[model samples]
Target: MMTGGPEPDSPDVMSVLELLAVGAPPARFEELLRTARREEAPDSTLAELDQAVRLASRVQALIGHAQQREAGLAALVDTAHDLTLVHGMEALLHEIARRARRLLNFDMAYIGLRAADDEGRASSIRAAEGETTSLSVGLKTFEDSGLGSLVQRSGAPAWSPDYLADRDLPHSPDIDAVVRAEGLHAILAVPLGYGTTVFGTLYGADRKVRHFTPDEISLMRSLGRLAGVAIERARLLEATRAEVTELELDTSRARSSLNVQRRVEAAYIRLIDLVLSGCDPQTLAEAAVKELSGALVVRDCVGRTIVVTGTPPRLTEDDVLRWTYDAHAAGCPVPMPDGGWVAPVTAGGENLGAILLVPDEPLTDGFGVRLLQLTARAVALILLLQRTSTVAHDQIRDELLDELLSDIRTQPRQLIPRARRLGIAIDEPHVMVLARPEGGPEGRAAAWASSYAHRMSGLMRFRDGYVTLLVPSEDPLAAATAVSEELTPLVGHPVTVGAAGPVSGPGRVAQAHREALSCLEALTELGNLGCVATPQQMGFLGVLLSENRGVGEYIRSVIGPVVDYDTQRFTELTRTLDAYFASSSSPTRAASDLHVHPNTVSRRLERIAELLGADWQDPERALEIQLALRLHRTRRTLQHRHAATGAARDAGSPAPRGSGP
Candidate 1:
């Protein structure tokens, strides 16, 4: 066989060549000797054999090196080209695995890519010539094994000199079996990085024990750089495609918005369903949640009977109180979930509950106001629909009014629920309201209400001709006189307002509301009031509570004990004991405020303490009684205030001061 070596026919030259077999520069010696023999000095044949053998030996070494280099270069170039041509990350990975196998001259090699979720996966593998492999394994997450973790964490370069001895690789009988099967003796894995961002890893292995050469490492690093470039190109292309997709999506959304308006008129149908179909609170909440959540990310959405401060699962009613947009707000997030946000609202400003959408991710540079407007409008529409529906219309109206007081017009007990939701302690002065616009239908009234509602973000109604003004004024007479004289000229029409004294919470709303309404009816003419009437004077609560004993029961369930206990622990007997003390006890103001004879007041005080327990002697308990007494007086005053207002409106007067604070 001709193995690219010299012929061995010459006689004496063979002896020389044989002698030179293990010497350095043997080819040069052979050439020198052959030149000498060509002169035919008589030893030419001997020299020829020596020269030919040396040349053959030199040629063999050169050919062997060239072959190894050729193999390595061809494998690397092919891998790069293949990876570049692959459609996706996985295909590139597979090609990498194949190349690693070929260039490593090893039995097994694996290629793993970085996962999006802070993980790495050995997703591709290849077996070298003469190596056996399992039929199943092609791709798997690194979380499946410690070896993968070690490779990923050690990001620089790693070597498992003896795969079996690698503690980090995990102990597996199967691993050893696989290693043996694949004929892997040593392994090296190097990280693939794009600039500073690590993308994945490249690995090489050999069947026989071998040192991973610096040259091999160098080549792999070059491949890594190539990988980075290719990946970046792919990423750029992907980004461009995503931008195009988003543009299309935005256009589709715009079209859908127009289409959505067509279905908006079907709100009446939804109202019917809500009323007749009996959607429970959970269902209603779920519906609201789904719409809000899917369309835009919101912090929370809640429809409430009482929009109070400390509430949860509800964005504050305060946000809706005076909002004027569509009377509502709704819109999807702008930019993207992570990048930016936007929202739009519908309902009229009169409808006061607000939707608050918040992105799960950080928003773009600036979009706070947009989010607010969008949420307000969207929530307003949804709530307005809930409110104006024939089903539970009165109840919805009452609740909406309560929520509206969160800030627009004035605070009321109806708003107490919201305060509670918002975690604010319930202790604000409040009043009842009653409104009747004599000359207008509901639509006209609503339009009129809008002007005022917008003025204060009235949370109750997303409409107009709304009654929103300070009620339960400390100076009810002064207020009446002022409103009569001032507002009459402005409205150019008569308006009478019934006022209730200070009150708070839904517990007392009805009581104050009925009286106010009565007072309003008593005034046949709307001659001077800025507002028709407030709930305090309407005094609807006492009657409503009498009919709905459950209302009292509910209140008792929530906070009755404190009121009852404090009343007894603090009030009765102390009144009688006060006379016994005989001290003047700040009598001048007390008498003036009480409008009672000092002697009579003194006698009543004496009677109070006698009934109280001996502990009543304690000054603290006296103060407690004083407080309870004040509370009772306040309630009665509220009840009585409506009549006082009626007297004022009857006389067609107003308070002297300007209503604007």
Candidate 2:
């Protein structure tokens, strides 16, 4: 051997150089060192060989550490990619645990999340992966010595190389029991979440005793950070998704409500148009039926059907009455027996009538019901307009009649033209009727008369607390009777109607009115309540009660046939009638007074029966005939006396009283 240094070509030196250059196993270099030592090499050579063996071991160890760092870096890159790809919190946490176990090369790995409200005071294992027993998952602890709490407090990684045997870190018995049961020897806990604020801990554990390298710890901490970011991303995505769902629901609801509002508005516009066009209740009901898809029945206040649209459900009068009452009480629509609704048509706090609706399908919401209510209001509006028109027309009629009957002198000049305009024929024959209610409401009789006059094409006037009418009728009795019959039930009491002449001309109205007033007064004086009568129907009292005081007409009405027969036949029937009355209806006595046979008197009586009715012998007829005969005889006697007086005056005057002779 050379003294200065081992020869460049030395076997041991060459073998070690070759092994270092080729990157061979340290075991091969060790085998060469042991063979040199056994062969008794020189001291210098042995020292050099020993140095070579030491150098080879350090270089190999450095190379192994570098390879481990490279592997950990590759795993970290993969873990970052996977953590970024994972979506939900739970799945991301599970993936993080799995990556942590594989990255750190641990027996098991898990993630522990702190209670949100505990502020790092408590934590529970949320996810686990690798060869973990069931005891590892869902493990929770509140102890300050637990690794999760330690990592949270320190805001850094906490590790135990041998959990059961380590004394450097605080220990919790509960956590220790889980460690023992799972046979976990080494455990490393790293903080997860943003810097300095750990919401949870990422854990890597092993069943075998092992010390954690800085690279492993660093890799695990990186993975925890990536997991924390991914978890937050997933939570935000979930929140965003929830917000979007809620917004979609709100949008849908708003759209539906808008659609309903549009429909309701359309219906309102159509109905308002109908109302403005002066449509009748029937037309309004038809529109409402179309809108509501139902049948409609409109009634009057008295429950008479004014109009019916669609096929309405049958309802009796009693049912309508009862439903109307209930609807009025409720001030809204009431359910009917046929699964329909009755809405009271009210205006100005008055129940005008009701609109009954029979729907084809039961209502699911207030939309249909609301339309029904709207229809009811529309119908009420139409009815109110019609009634207003009617009332106005009636007022006009009343005013015309009042002006006509007020001053008869000016009636033909001004009122006749106006009457013609109103379709009232004042020139035609019309009976004047005056009436008074016997124990009834004060104003109802006037209302009844107004309405009746309108219906009968007549004129009505309420003056001085009496209802007066001028109706076109030939029969005064019939007109008076009609007034009584119509006005009684309306006023809920008896009505006394007194009628007079069926006046033919305009100026005669006042005279007829006076005669009717006198007849009314007569009937009242005679206690004829609720009785209808004309002056002619009152018999002889009619002439006395009449304003014209028709005496000659009354006499003619009673015995005109007899007087005409005596004049036309040139007979003594008047003398025989006077004798008969003087003999107290004894024809034989009368015949004896006339110096004739009773048989001749009987023939004259038969002729009188033929001229007068067969009932001439009746008590009432006899009385009327007797009164007429007396009046007739008195008038004839006065005429004879006046004639004698005229002749006496002529005789008493000087025949030659003429100054000219």
Candidate 3:
């Protein structure tokens, strides 16, 4: 195998020594030695050259070993730097495997992390580099066999040259198969960790049978220790980051809570200021709406609107009432249509009203709802105060009305002042209206009367089972008629009203009241239920029913013969006489008025004269006949009107077509 170096016969000891000292090829040294021996130089010279060549060869080998160690140490320094910079455990493991294969000149290098479960324990290859087949990353091995287990258990480096033949350690058939498949003949591994806590092992293997030097094993151990420290450092950093994140979340929550409190405080201050300013319910509601940037409607207990602010959601009265009921029951704000909300305005357990709010946008949280509740409470207080004031005023007015209607006559001096205080001018002309509830509950009639009287600025009270109002008016009958029409629908039944007086002062009130009562009685007696009447409108019937009863004498004298004729014949000769007189005694006009021919009228009149005396045609008697006929017709018309009303009443309907006398 040695060629082109030196001839074997030539003696060249100095030259070969020079070549050996300068690190020439082994072939060159071998050729120089062969030439020195063939030259047959002196035995001492041959021996000296041989010793010199051997010494030079030994020195060269030492220098080469030193340089390799130096290079390995430099690579270890670079690995330490790389490990310190690596951020994750897996990346550091891969880098360690790569550096190990490069430094040791192994066919394959890999790291195996120890994994233990309740069922069993094993080492799984986590990272690998170089030419690997069966011993790839994620390969697992049990502790019974494999170099990983030996290194982990002993906490030391392990190596086996000619791994298939080594029998000092237990070998698993499966592990051997993997090693053979990987074409590995030698293996070296070092425990990766500090002290006795070996997390895993780093492995390096060669395809050819070769011994692993101690320096290489030690270098790998150093790298494994550095990898373990790096992994622990990464874990600590990750835990610190988690803690920082949680702290930030808590801080954000605290800030949000503080902000909410501040806003609530500000809103409370604004509400208190509004209340102290004596603002009306509407004004206060508007302020609240402005603050919340929403619309609101406030309603009273009876579902009447008290105030409305902004353009609240469109809802019917029934919708508002339903929402109010639900909110009151729940004692909280409830959602409504169009992104609105409703809250009951309650005070001292009384649901005074409700407030409906329609926001410009939907609420994102409970704060807006809570704000609405606060506003509702403010509105409730305002409503309660208003109601209390109204009740006190009504009490005063009711007391005054009671005194005015009292039967005991009070001096004008004593009454006028009291009347003026209640906004009534007792000295002015006022009519006394006596109203009787017809086929209806008296209590509701009285309540409605009181309310109506208040609206008219008059006085009302229940007296002698009648709801009476003394209102300012010149036409008592017209006022009575107006009251009847107005009260019919409200009471859900008919009401008969009888009015008397343009009574001038408080002194004449009792007399006027008696007149109204008598008129009311006359209406009932005449079958005129649900009718309005005054003494003047009742004509002669009114005159007959008056306190002065002398008009009966005049009636009997003027129409006695006709009355007797009617009683005898059971005919309406008296009605014919009355129509004749009403038509100015013209036979033709009288026939037309009675819806008959002139012959019938003339014959009736002749019969009436025959029943009395022929002298009834004289002017003195004729004048008397005319007056009596007029009175009789008045009575007959009233009787017919009464009959019609009675028929209607019997039918269980409203008053007949004609309303008043």
Candidate 4:
């Protein structure tokens, strides 16, 4: 691209060339050809290009002077720094070499960094252009590579005027080829040193035979000295970097240790609190999630659990734990005796849940067995924390509901808005259900309870021991019944059941909660195992029966006359009617809840309508009856508990004998 320089024939150009040749070595003449350039130009442009070329050479000649070299050295030394270290050593060195070669006009150059051991050296063929991409310039070893060996073995600069002709060393096939093809008339190699250690070498090549001028040799020496100092600086910078790396590693370890220590301390405190409070596993779990998730920097930690032994309570859409049950049997991470950690979280060998700890780095030491063992212990503790937390959550739920039951019936209206304002969550048309384990550990039972509470209301262990939930969209009776069925597997024992009919309103939410609790308590046996109700499941009837303290007791008083009307008859009748009615919506499943053939349900419906003087053929009356049963069930549940369990329950419990919440 350059069109100026001394011309072959001009007097002024010859004169400058002559001065340049005064001490130029005959060994370097051909090498100059590789660096020199010529281009066609108009007469005036040629003149200007020649002037520019000569001017640059003149200026560069002065760079051999003391001051410029020093500045260059400082720049070279400073470049080995910063987050750039992320690139590792080889890439960093190559960048430096490439810049130096292009800047200094060296035909080719390389940096061979020596190692502490005599044979331990790592060097880069740092820069080469007019070369193939796959081409490599230096041999890897200290012994085979000339620049590497010279930098390590020689105490001073080494010159190879005729590289192939140099009898003192051996050459590889690639180097031999480079010597012949490059017309490499000579090479001047210099050792870059730090104190007594030869850290690396710097070299320049000549493509033709010519003598090196005094200034040329001086420039080479100057460049070499700068490179030597720069290499030493780079090494010191690198060494300090290594030290910083060690410090950072230590700091990271300390930080992680602090975090783990904090978690352990928190766990211990929780265990103590659980014991003192006599809270079951569900309660403990709820408390742990509230405390631990807040204390640590974990996201959505508690719900990603799978309960194998105990049936879990109803979960809403957002409860991740509901999905985890699908995961445990698929990919287990807990370790087995076969020497890998792959076992999942299980309570008493029953897969209760799987715990996940997502760390910025893999939780691996990548070191000795002792560190690995410590890692295992840490993981074990984490799993223990998750499992214990689940149990604690469930136990707290019933106790929580029991505590708040009184408030629900008193203020039946403040439900939805209260829930939203308190950061308590609710899904509309939601139903609430209650259950307690028959003969399981209080902790596990409670954990299941809290889990469902969270699932049903999207509320997790809020305030004292309460769990609010959001139920899915389905018929209220069907959904509540399904929830009860879903819970049996989680609690791992026979459980009672109660459910609220679907209704919307802040005030009415309390009514729903009470309904659920009452149903569960009153129907503790198989008579109401699958969302069925004895007279206990129905609303208050006579004045005498209605005057009773509890619906179950009231139901018992009226049920003596209907003793022969056992759970079976009720189950069959309800099943038939549900099937016949829901058949319009393809309610075969609803019929299943009633335990009857779909066709038989049709006939039962006709007979019932005939007896009640209502027309089964009339959709309106049929729907009314269904709604009434649902409401009856809902009312039964509410009579036993306060309606204010929903968010709006803040005012106070309503007086007794007010129409059911």
C-alpha local distance difference test of each model: 0.45, 0.75, 0.72, 0.45
Task: Tell me model 4's lDDT, rounded to 2 decimals.
Answer: 0.45
Name the best candidate (by lDDT): 2
lDDT value for model 3: 0.72
Off by over 4 Å in 3: 1-279, 291-308, 311-384, 387-396, 434-454, 462-467, 481-499, 514-576, 579-661
1-661: candidate 3 lDDT, tens digit per residue: 6444443455556776567545577767766667766767778878877887787788788778769866876766666656556656677777878888887888898888776462326888888887546356667778778777787667778889988889897788877887878888888888765223567788888889988776676666666665554544444334434534544565467786655545544674577567545568988887887767877788765455768777765687567767777898899899976678889876535446688888887877555776787778667655543443343345446555656666765345678887888788888999989988775545445546656777788988764557888999999888998888776654557888888888877777776777888889999998998898876666555565444334555566557767877888798888787777777778899899889989998889888778768888788777766766776668767888888788778899787666443
Choose 2 or 3, whichever is better by TM-score: 2
Error of 4 at 128 (Å): 75
Residue 626 shift from truth in candidate 2, angstroms = 2.2
Clashes of 1: 125
Best by TM-score: 2
Please estimate how well model 1 matches the true structure, expressed as its whole-model Cα lDDT.
0.45
Q: Deviation in angstroms for 32 in model 1? A: 15
Score residue 344 of candidate 4 by CA lDDT. Answer: 33
Consecutive 10-residue window with the lowest summed lDDT within model 2? 1-10
TM-scores, all models, native as reference: 0.30, 0.48, 0.35, 0.28
lDDT of 1 at 597: 70
Model 4, span 1-661: residue lDDT tens: 3223333433334434553555343222322332233333356644654574455465446544536545543443333222123234555456555654554465665665555564545554554443333444653544565644564565556666677777786666666665576666567666665323455666666665545454344445444444444444344335434633554566567885555444444454454446334444444444443432311111122344321212232335333344444434543443222222222333222333443322223334422222222222233333433333332233233223433334534444434454554344433555554444455444444445445556555332222122233353435456555655665565445655455645444444456666555555566533554343322335452111222235344433432222223253663443344454555645456556666576665565555555445553466645545554444456646755555343234556544454334
Q: Which stretches of candidate 1 lie over 4 Å from their true place?
A: 1-63, 119-151, 165-184, 205-213, 256-661
State the lDDT at 554 in candidate 1: 35
- Encode model 2's per-residue lDDT on 1-661: one tens digit a residue: 2132222334477767767776776667766776777777798988888887788788888788869866766666566555555657788888888788777778898888877677657888889887546777777877477777678876779888888898767778778888888888989998886322467889899889888887677667767766665665455445434634554465467776655545655685688678758788887788878878878888765456879888886677667777887887798888886789989876545556788888999866666876676677667656644553343344457656656565535326666776888888887889999998877544445545655676678898765567889999999999888878766655557888899978876777878888899888888888987888888988788877777757788888888988999899898787888888889989989999999899888888888899898999899888888888887887776677666666657788643332222
